[model samples]
Every structure is written in structure tokens, then in C-alpha cells.
Target: MSEKSTVPGQFTLVLHSHLPWLAHHGRWPVGEEWLYQSWAATYLPVAKVLRNLAAEGRSHLLSLGITPVLAAQLDDPHCLSGMHHWLGNWKLRADEASMAGNTALGAHEHRLATEALDDFETRWRHGSSPVWRELIDAEAIELLGGPLAHPFQPLLDERLRTYQLHEGLADAQHRVGHTPAGIWAPECGFTPGMEKNYDAAGISHFMCDGPALRGDTSLGRPVWDSDTVVFGRDLHVSYRVWSPKSGYPGQPYYRDFHHYDHASGLKPARVTGKTVAGPDKAPYDPELAAAAIERDVADFVATVRERLFSESERIGRPALVVAAFDTELFGHWWHEGPQWLDQVLRALPEAGVTVGTLADARDRGYVGERVELADSSWGSGKDWRVWAGDQVADLVDLNTDIVRLALDTLDKMRADQDGLRDPVADQLLRETILTISSDWAFMVSKDSAAGYARDRAHEHAHAVREIASAISGGQLAKAQRLAAGWAAADGLFPALDARRLGPALGGNDESGGGSLRNHAGPRGRRMDAEGPR
Candidate 1:
């Protein structure tokens, strides 16, 4: 018998980039500081990696999901101004270190900080608003859009979910000049009926975890109830680079994430070894870490090549090995992550393995059969416990009650008024949507920044409760007063209109599902009117 010919293999690398709506929110354990840090460490560095590869005539495929909320923040004038100031401050700090430190250390610090600042200024001169446009112009990346402000979809009231999804897509298109073909599903939180809404939005595909795939994972394929394809991340391939417990980043030579210098509040240590405690970790050295990155890149390439070859031979078709990760992980968590990415993208093609985007894989006919996906997330243990854990049970209850009350209030107001002319009611509606953001509850549950998270959740909840009470008791003046106070603090999504949610709040249609359709008009009016109240 003649030996069978094996099919070629393929893989996609997807990175999801997001930060909460924090343009006005300032620096702290959780706020705009997080945004600046990720920008300096991950976004800018990742952009350089992609740009370099593209310049070299290498086609390295990667999918990047930039949430609409994040896009807004990136494009915000205030954020752009703040980022410029922040970059200049970084350089100043480096100069200070150089003046106080050993000459070699000083020189290295100043050089890196100066180079980073120069790159940030050159690449983002169009201000924060045009970063997405620049990336699209280069065609070095594929953009993945998501619901406005990253709400947990399954738990949201259907009307609000529809409004968020619809408005988010519109916002992305307005900003990026193209309707997105895929969504990141806000924390990879997917429900049974979401695909129908996705199909209505003209999205061709979305991503979920590997376990969401039917049978054994091989390639992305369409899900049932809609024609939009779902690509499942191959956890086996991804975890090799960065897992919770083990990954290349956790190696002895890599920079330690936890052992930061108390005075500077900057990480200043290397892992040294698995047994090394936080206090005892060795000081970080960029030169040593660079060497480690080289070794890890080689190892990663070997693993991908082996998996692709073996799987192709077994299946007699092209095999995909997706490696999905959070964009924050690159330089924020693992200081060497950006360098490792640069090395891996440069080396993968030489290993005879293809590097391609999710869209490319789909276009080349790599997708397989469709299946009904389960409710899933990429959180702790691949479950929703992180968002709905015991620590946040009360928060979940509070949010649920407030959302129902807001929806009921909205219904009553719409029924009572001739049109959506009530500014008081409009403010109430905006507060309601802000209160319903899944981010607050998630932060509370994770204890990542528990105090701020609890405060924000309660703040929005109080606004909703008070507004509903005032409206119900016929205290229109008091309701208006309270709306003004809350608006001053949380004035985002100002264009939110309660009228567009309509009567079918939680109802789903027989096929796919009912979504809030855009009302025809100027873009701003449509966005404001169609978004969730």
C-alpha cells in the first residue's frame, strides 16, 4: 500500500486587549494607571513586533480584540494628553535613576525609557483616537470588537444585552471604519442565544475556549442557531507559553512579577528558581532575561512544529494549533513577554510552520463541523465562578435587583411620556446602564481592587435605586437632583437612550434572537438612541 500524504497544518494567535472605561479614573491599584502601564509595556511593544514582521515581508497571523470601551479610552483626547505626560515622566524617572545609579545601569535605563517614549510619540502622534486607524492601515493586525464596556452577557437583561451588543458594533465601525467580523464576547462569556445576535450584527465569527469545541478540537467552525463561526483556543498549545502555574515566563531566569521594589513600586527581580520566595528573588537583569527569551522561543517553535506535523499526519488534513492569551500578559505580567513574541514570530516560519490570523485560517477552508456551544468562560478553571463567586454573591444579587428595577422604571417612563423628551428620565437611563456594567461586579469578585469595585457597584446601584424610588413616589424634583449628582461622577455613555430597548426586553425570537436594530439618522443620534439605558 502506498503511504498516504499528510495535509498541511495551520494555527492562529489571538490576543484580547481591553481595559475598563477609565479615562477620567486616575492612577491607583485599579484605574487609568493600569491603562498607562499596559500601553507602555504591552501595546506599544506588541505594535513594534507586528510592524517589524510586516516590514520584513513576513506574514505573521494574529488576531487582536480591542474592546470598544478600550478603543474609546485610547482615542480619548484626555487620555492622549495624559499618555504623553506619562511617557515624558517615564523618561524623567529613567534620567533620575541614571543620575543616582551605577553608570552602566543609568545608561541602560535612560536608553530604554527614551526609546520607548520616542516610539510612543511617533506611533501615536494622531493622539489616542487614531491608534486603531493606524493599525488597520498597516493591515498588520485584525481587530476584534465587543460589547460596549465589557458586560457579562449571560447575566444581563436581554434588552440591555441587545442594546450593548448593537451599539458596541456601531461604535467600533464608527471608530475603525469597518464592521467587525468577530467579537471577543466580553471575557469570553457566551450564552446559548448570543450567536443569533452576532449573526444579526454581520459578525462572521467569534472566539471561545477549546473545551467549547465539539468532539476533539482541530479547527474553528460555525456554531448552530447561526452561521457565525466560533474558533476555540487550543489551550494545550497556549499554556506552554503562559499558564497560571507554569509557563516559560515562570522560568528561573525570567523577571519576577510579584517582587516589586517598595520604594519605586516597580518590579525589580528575577524568578531565580521555582523555590525562590517573593522576598528572596534575585534582582532582574534585562540582558539575562533576553537570553531566556531566546531559549523559550526556540522551545516554543519546536513544540508547535511537532504538534502541527503529528496532527497533520494523523488527520490527513491541515491542523490548527491556536495559542490565545490576554494582551496584558505580554509585558505587564512577564516583563520579557514582548521580546519573546518578537523572537517567536521571527523564528516560526523558519521552522516550516505557518503563522496566520483567524480570518486567514477560515478563508483557507480550515474550519470543520458546527455544534451547539456550552456556556463558557476563560476564567479560573474555565468557569464563571470568578464573576459569580461566593465573595461576590451579594454584589450579584444587588446588581440583579437594580437592573430589574431600572428596566421597570424605564418601561413606566416610556409608557407615561409622549416621547423620550424627559431629560430626567434620560439621565436615569444612563445611570441604569452604567450601573449594569459587568466590570464593577467582576472587580469586586476578583478582589483585584475590591474597595474601588465595591464603591463603584454600590454607587451605581444607589443611583438606580434612588432614581426608581423618586420616580415611583412622584418625587420628580428629587429624582432630577439625584440624577445630576450621579451624572457628575459617572457621565460616560451620555447618549444612552432608554426608548430603544422597546417592549421585548427579555424575550427572544424563535430563530436566532431579537436584537436592537439601529434607527436611521446621524451616527451620534443613532448611537445615543440605540444604546442601553
Candidate 2:
């Protein structure tokens, strides 16, 4: 009747783009450097690729998850100027390498740095929100928003978790001009009944790991009486290209992320081999890596087609195969990733497999039956061990105490004075959310940046405790001073107001009308730093 829709099944590619608030934290090895590196290497390049495809009339190609915290950084004027400076310095570093006789390496890096600078100055001159809005408006990609500061919602206090989820989506609406219908739950972490929270927040769908669905991730499933659907990552298809033991990026020809030339502060060597030492590794070659990308693209397309075809037959319906990954895995971690992505997206459609966003898949009837998802995450052992296990016990204890103190302080303040604009309380809440971020625990467990992570966690916790004490002691002047200082340092969410925490403190109203303040949800609009901007 309608040509029978020859598409066997739908394949959705989800890339999670996130980074902690890094501006003014530190430079060099960790803090701001991490943000700039990913911004240039991953964010910009991926945006370019998506824009190019959109120019070719590709719509709803994939789902892009951008954390609220990362969005704040992108939109901040401070970070914009800092990122511009970083690019200029990046080109200088490459020139220095060339002067030292590493011309080939320097030339490659210099070209990249130059192009990134030009792109930033041209398209990103205003802010990243406008750039992303263009893509969203074009229907070229579906955007996924997460909680403010990327807190691990399952481990958080229910009240705090709700506050974060609502505020996060609100912030995204503020920036991107449209509330996201879906979210990429931080770390794919979830607990039963969390779907109810998603429902209340106006979220239509979200994602989790395969184990959360008992390994049946062939289709998006409605959970717990909520029409809000949950999609799980299909590891069988995803791991075909990138796994711990082996991945296309780990191949000898791709640029090595770890090994860096000390003088130029740039990575110049290819991965070479698993056991190869940095000093002994071979120089990176662009031509060889380009060839590898094509081969991997072909293999990956075949893998997705086969997985979808087999699952469609077994399940007796059109299935959906979602392969999710960290957005940084492309240009940041895997130097050749963006190019490979470009190839795969183009190849899949030609290979007779449908490529579309998760929303598109659902609209085309790829949803399965309702399910009861277990408490799970996409971490080690397919459980919550990474964020809440014995390895991070101290940090876990700190998060509990910090969230409690901040909520208690805010509730007490509201009891005394209703509808007072308290910057001190607002900043305290900001510090509390930063401390509860899931990154600290994950870093500690993995030992990747344990020291920096632990320090950051404690730093925010200390700030929260100090500001709360100043408020509780009736030292309003002292509290304001302390808050002003912390706001100068860890200030990311400018639209966050202390009154937004009312619902989390046992207030009945979703809109803050019957509560201490009169702030509406992000969808309906909310108060800004200067009041209703």
C-alpha cells in the first residue's frame, strides 16, 4: 500500500558530550586544558561534520546528548574568551615544534589548530547555543539534556535529584530555545521509580545500559506505567568498533592520546602497538589512518545491518539497534574518530540500513512492550559499583552530608524570610550540586585522575559547609561574602536561584507559587540571576 517501508530496522547513534565545569579551576595538565582540548578536538569537529551532513539534507541523523554543565561552559562569556586564547596558544605550540625540527608533526598540528581557530571565530563567535540551535531547528539531530552538573541521580537524595532534573532541563530550554524530550542519564545510571520523576519533568524518553533491560535492548521499552520510554545501549553492536581490549582507535596507525612530545606539549606518535613504549612508538601517519577509517566504516555498517536483521526476525518486528558512545571518544580520545563517524553515517544508509535519531525510531514504531528495569548502570560489572562502591566511600559520605546541609540551610532560610533574594543560599546550592557530581566518584574508582577528582570534591564540600554555617549562624554579611567568593570560582549556572530549591525541600507545588518563591518550570520560564531576565 505504501511501498511496505523497505527499511528492515532502525539504527540510532547516540554520542554523549560532557565535561565538568573547568573554567578558572586549573590549567596546564587537568582543569581548563581538559575542556579546551575536548572543545577543539571533539566538540567543534563533530559539530562541523553534523552541519555538513545537514547541508546535504540529512535530517534526524542521530541523537546528541549535551550535559547541562557543559552547555553552561559553552555559553559562558569567560570560557569563550579563554577558549579563543587557548587556540592561539595551540598554534604557537605547533610552531615551536616545527622550529625544533619536527616539521611533519608540527605542520599537521598547526593546520588543525589554524582551522579550529578559524571555525571558532566564524561560527562560534557569539556562543555555542546558537550553533547548536541551528542544528536542532534543522531537525538534523535530536538534543538530549541531563541534570545540572551531571549528578548521579540514583545515588542522590530524591528531593535533590528532582531539583537537579527539573533545573537541568530548564537550563537547556533557556539556552537552546527548546526543551529536550529525552535525556542521557549520567553514566546511564537509573533506579526503579526514577521514570516517574522523568514523567513529571516532561521528559518523554531516556537511556540506560543493556543490563538494565536484562540484555534485551532490541527496542525502546515503556517502563513503570509511564509512557516515557527507556532505550538501552546494544553492546554487541557498539563494542564491535570500540571495546576495552580492542578498538579501531587502538590500532597502530591512529594518534596516541597518552604519549606526548614534552617540548611541543603535543602528541606526535601513533599507538604503534599495545606494549610499545612512548619513545619507541612510530610517528603518526595521516594517510594510513585515513585508509583504516574506510575499512572500519565498512565493517561497522555490516555489523549494524546484521544485528538489526537478526534481531528483527527473532523479535518478529522491526527492531532498533542503538550504539551509544562518549562524544569525546571521537576527536578528543580517538584522533581519527570524527572522520570515521562521517564515513559510517554516510555508509549505513547506502548499505540499506536506516539511520535516524532515537525519536525517529520510536515514531516509526520501534517501541516494544512495557518493562520493569532493574537498578543498574553501564559501569563496571554492569552495576552501580563505580559510583557507590567501597572504593569511593569517603566521597560518597561527603556527598550525602553536603546535599543534606545545603537543603537544610535553604529550607531554614525560607522559614525565616519568605521571598528574599539570597545570593548566599543560591551559591551554596551551586556548590552542593558540584560536589555531588558523579565524576568525582568515577574518577576515584578508575584512578584516572583520582587526586584532582578527590580534591575537587572536597573543595566544593568545604565551600558548602562554610556557606551553610555562615547562614545558619545569622551572619548574613559573612555568608554573602563567602558566597561571592565561591561564585567567582565555581560559578557555572547563572540562572540558578536559591528559591528553585523549594520543591526539593518538601514544598507541594511544582511552580513555586504556593512555596517561598514564584519561579516557574523551565518550560514555562524561570527567574534569572538578576530576576526574570
The prediction achieving the highest lDDT against the true structure is 2
Deviation from native of the Cα of residue 210 in model 1, angstroms = 1.3
Q: All models: lDDT?
A: 0.73, 0.86
Worst 10 residues of 1 by lDDT: 519-528
Assess the local accuracy of residue 390 in candidate 1 as a C-alpha lDDT between 0 and 100: 62
Question: How far off is residue 203 in model 1, in Å?
Answer: 1.7
The runs of at least 3 residues in candidate 1 whose Cα sits more than 4 Å from the true structure, single-residue gaps closed, are 1-7, 58-60, 102-106, 418-429, 469-489, 493-496, 506-533
**TM per candidate:** 0.87, 0.93
Task: Give one digit per residue, the lDDT tens place, for model 1 in 419-515.
Answer: 8466677677666666656677677766678787777777777878888899999998998888887766555555556666657433343211322
Put down candidate 2 lDDT per residue, 268-329, tens digits, no spaces: 99999999999999999999889988888988988888898899998998889999999999
Off by over 4 Å in 2: 1-7, 503-533
Name the lDDT value of residue 218 in candidate 2.
92
